[model samples]
Target chain A: MTAWDVIGFLLVLATAAGIIIFSSKQVRGKYPALFRKIPAITRLKRAVGLSVEDGSRVHVTLGKADLTEAANTSTLVGLSALHSIGQLSANSDQPPICTSGDGGFALLSKDVLRAVAMETNTREYYDPDLGYLSGATPFSYALGALDALEESGAKTNVLIGNFGVEAGWLTGNAEKHAQFTLAASDSLVAQAVFMATSQDFVIGEELYAVPAYLAYRPAHIASLRVQDILRFLVGGALLIGALLKSLGLL
Target chain B: MKILNIIIAVAAGLIVLLGYFFRIPAIDDLRGQLLNWAVTLSGVAGLIAILNLIFGVHWKRVKEKHERRGASLVIIISFAVTLVAGIFLGPSSPGFQKLVTHVQVPIESSLMALLAISLVVASLKILQRHRSWMGFVFFLCVVLFLILNSGVLAFTSEIPVLRDFLSAFHHAPVAGARGILLGIALGSLAAGIRVMIGSDRPYNG
Candidate 1:
């Protein structure tokens, strides 16, 4: 809202645009993996593949990410991962199930599923019921997901989005019922719970690294490149700010 | 059709973005209108989703003769009764408020109590499941913070070096958390810019 805030936003926007344009080209012809190995993503991908072979569904629960909040970023990350997984598991007997706590996000998730289904020529196997809003509130969402997870009988559970302390129930339930489970969230509180309960807890921004790891597609790779560049820029900014403040110049 | 969807979405997003940067009266009005429409649509979608979730879950159970059929019926009844009561008596009504205060709060509190127990069991299981150095370090850090910050050792604060060390330890998580938050912010910006450039479109699948 202030001048400095606007300047900062525009600075980031310009940098992102530059990197995105550059990386879009570089991602062509099998770019080398630029990211570290994430064990959680490895397990998540394997769980999806194993679900395909075993003919069980992979349950993807995206907790409430209201459009008006910053947590919607995590929802975008979730949607991308879902799309990648949808394409990867398109030929399976049962398509992955997507659940959300918000209706708008549920709609977006359903669209991603439908689009993936269409592109893969698996329209016949796709069901509209595959995507749904689970519950309205935090605890209700978790309790609702518990019932849904039980009913679906999915072997693999992947929970990614904006979760709160209420995620304890869903992760606890998944731990008990599912064969493979990995949970991630943008909320620090939820992340704490996940570290303790979930089979694989994706820490920090590794949640954002999911699509690049899962799909290995060009666009996601480009996004990842932009992210890395921005991280360096941010780290440099932090160091500069610290030095300036220490010298009484900031 | 896909191109049109992308264009429409991008255009609307641009307008919204512009509204944030500029405080012009006309742009502000337009932004308000657009946001109002979005809120209305979101509310309608929520209503539809709730109804679908309630009826669909219970209906499928009943039709399929699932073991939870009886429980499903009870849920359906509870949802309908609650909906009817909420609509007729209004959300601000004392009885409706009691439904939240008396029933919902107790249930949520019990679950929170369960979460505390779960946290303890999960920490123990962390050792059993993940015996790596990272796991050990994580467990050590958490336990160290827990014990140190709990005022269990007041004598340590009397020593200047120990007090300084403990103070720094208390602030360590904040620094780490701030670093993580910065990473997330950068990632969000990248993701949002991708949408703007049409490199990613989760809206139309």
Candidate 2:
């Protein structure tokens, strides 16, 4: 390993650990306020509440990527958000239906649903059918999801995960079905697609902030804080590098 | 059980993560072995998932007496036929290749072609809904990029203004894309750290 690689890895580890430890020790209401305006998150809250009140289902697609990849932070965050939404929808006759393209992800989604159901004392309503594989590939997954969402007549479509241009079709299909859609993904192209197709959408790392926005989990919130700090550091470093380059300094 | 799950996750993740950096022989061997096991398990899981999807859909159709039962039957027949053909005729055989090329490729292509129209409609929708500077700028960029890059207009490179605008616009979005990619990388790293330290455990679910 290069010196820089080690340093970078250690820096990330230390910062995250420090923040997590600090945040866990703080009492309720004592944690520092870290807030941002993400319309998709706001819409997700309203959609969940509305779906429960109106006796409609909420469908959450975890996109095409599985947990095996190194860069599957999107799926992780999506699962976290799904857990929170699952808990919120527990009281409803129809809880949220979580779908995934990968088999392992489907299994994880089911586990999350069961955990949420148990936490909410609604285990009887937990159905394995609610979380299962839609399709293996990206386009196939999109097609499968589109058909299922339309057939189910779900009121709320929460799509957050690693998707590509296929995401455009899913969002468009949801719109055609007159469903309230909230979309987010770690893929830039998919994020761009979401930006164009869905009014309530998240971009970039704002997706990682979903768990914090929904559940208010201390560690998740602290991770966001650490992310912000790292982002500023990286941005400042880039600025310095650019300035140095402009001055013909190495 | 929970501690064991955490232990397995941490050990496997650390071996893989650190093996990439340190050139330790034992760590590299362990990483390779674990990854192979993971791949094999993933394949089995994938097969199970397909079975789950097929039976789940078919049973639902039968119970509800949905008209799509015929479609589900067709899917089963097709899946069985493909599996048999792949196993007997070999995947590289002309039959398998032709089936994939003729069926799967076209379906994927149609979806992609559909995306072009979806993109345009989505951009228009964005403009209609937002009606703001950001929306206008985004709309203009998409239109300009499509026109200049897609070769919709029969314009020559001789036109200085069009050429300059096209050249500049082509690289403009790359800067933003790079920023987004970097942000995603950083976010993933932080997330990995959280998981490694047991602060966040998606596997528990």
Candidate 3:
């Protein structure tokens, strides 16, 4: 590795480790809001509560992100959100159904649901059927999810992950059925689809932030905090790079 | 056990990640081997899931006189036939390719067609509801993109100023898209670091 690569990697590692450690040690104060206001999250909370009261299932679909490097992070973020949904649906008559296009993602979803069930002391309600491999590709997965949504009569549909243009199909289906739909994606096309279809859609890093809001675990909060800091650092770097280029100093 | 697994995960993850950046031969070999194992395991898992879906879910549903028994039967037969054809004739064989080309391609094309309609409906909905400048801008861009591609305004390309304006307008959204993509990349990198460090353990369960 080059010196710059090694230095950059170590810098990030150290900074993240320090932040995580410090954040973990902090306790709640009188005014202890760790993150900024996300209106979509507030709406999500209300939607989940309403869905529970109305005896309708919340459908959570992690779109067609497989175990490849290009999509692995999106899958992980989806799983994190699924973790929150699992907890949210714990007391409800209808627990959230987690579906994925990839088998590996589906298997991981099952594990997350199982963990949630265990945490909620609802192990008996834990069903592997709840986390399913819907289809192998994006379109097939969307169609499969649409079928499930129709059959289950789910009131709330939360879609997150690496959906493509096919996300429009699922989100449109939800809207047509008058389901309360919220969506987030790493894909720009899918994000556009979500913005068009979902009334309250999480944008960009907001998908990762939802889990922190739902669970408020120190680690999740710390990770979000670090992400924000890193984002700012990137923004600063971009500005500086632009300035240097304009000045012909590079 | 959990601690051990976490350590293993971190170590293996670090090895694979660094192997990409660093040109260490040993780490590269290790990365390749681990990736192969992952792919192989994933393939096996997929096969098992397919079999379970066909037999454990679809077959059981058919046997139990479910409402969608016909659908279940169709799924099972199609899956079985595809699997057998794929195995016996080989995945590259004409039958398997034809099955994919005829069935999968058409389904994908249908979804794409649906996406076009949905996009129009969605854009219209946005205009009707939001009626904001940004929404109007989006709608205008969509229209312009469609018109440009439709070849109805192909003669506009002959006009230098009009062509420049159209070209710049077409690429404007792409710039915004690139910014969003950069943000996603940075966010993903940060999140991946969290996972690697075991702070945000989606794999824990």
Candidate 4:
């Protein structure tokens, strides 16, 4: 919108890129303080492991996000989580099942699933049906995914993406039927619903921390490091703005 | 192929992202074309998904004689009828539009009502099932907001302290929502940078 805003945006990206390079080159170092331990993420890890042992599939639903829309980043993060889970469960007796509400997202997820299946050398387990387009709209998504999930026989539900209050039905359904459930959403309303219904949930930026928790890659750690630094900067900016406002200098 | 894919992704991402900040005609033109392609791809993807839903999911269920075969059959029939009607009658036709307004709108409205009730039910279980300080705080906030927004606290607003409290209540959700929005924005920035740099590749499968 303005030069200052553009500079600030670029700074965030540059900072993330810089840390990613730095973190990747390090031979050994402690994980960032912010991501050292996240209970919800740790629980999701445990859920995946338990799923493997129980031979029950994990269900991941990427709430409807079009690539051209504002919520695409949320869907991308959901894909990150789904990719991690797919690899983790690729060799298991039962693999993970994923669903999306948007057609484009569903298409991309299907490709991701197939690729994960191939990489994990579990081609037999790869069903094109593994990734489903549950619905085209919000309410239809809830109803369609409810049926798809029920039929998948998945014991764990990992919902990460953009969702509406319609997510309440899905999370509520999981509460009754699922052995484990965790949710994260880009939509504030859906996040609130998840908190009320789901046993474990990542709120706000914590949704982006899933990859770091699930797979200890350098890039993932770098992402957390960048988030921590930027969050501090944002907090400082907010405080200064508040001070300025109170002093009538803003 | 992987290298080529990354190259293409990074190049397209860079061009599109920079197009907003830069005023070059070539870059803007390229960005527009890229965006158009993306939309086309999205539409095709949607079509593929519908086909998958019909043939891979419902049709299979029907053929397999699953317990939900009846529901699958109904979905298949409805999809066929809708597709045919839309093709013949055109989506702008009054009959087709009415089908949406009368049939789909009412169904969606009913689902919305159900979703609200479901949220209430989940709220009832929050403190009981969770039993954490966070759960208690969330539950308290929900009740507080509900009471404030329900007009029950309007009379109390005449009192000085109550008025101040009500003012804070009005702004509380906004403040909380703003904070969350900031966090989400930063998170998205970090994630987008990751993808642009090819450090994290969701498309790489």
Using DockQ, give the best candidate's number: 4
* lDDT of candidate 1 at residue A29, scale 0 to 100: 46
lDDT of 3 by residue, A9-61 (tens): 77567656755664555533432545678877788878888888888888888
> Every model's DockQ, to 2 decimals?
0.62, 0.65, 0.55, 0.69
Candidate 2 per-residue lDDT, tens place, A95-138, comes to 78878889888888888888888888888888887888888889
- Fnat of candidate 2 is 0.67
Query: First chain TM-score in every candidate?
Result: 0.92, 0.94, 0.92, 0.91
- In candidate 4, list every pair of residues with a backbone clash: none
TM-scores of all models? Answer: 0.95, 0.93, 0.91, 0.95
Instruction: Please state how well chain A of candidate 1 matches the true chain A, as a TM-score.
Output: 0.92
Which residue segments of model 3 deviate by more than 4 Å?
A11-15, A27-33, B129-134, B144-171
Worst 10 residues of 4 chain A by lDDT: A26-35
* Local accuracy of candidate 4 as per-residue lDDT tens digits, A187-230: 99899888888888988988888877887677777877788888
DockQ comparison, 1 vs 2, better candidate: 2
lDDT of each: 0.82, 0.82, 0.78, 0.84
Q: What interface RMSD do all candidates show, one decimal each?
A: 2.0, 1.7, 2.1, 2.0
DockQ-based class of model 3: medium
lDDT of 3 by residue, B18-118 (tens): 88778889999999998898889788777765665567567878999989889889888887888888999899988889988999899788779878987
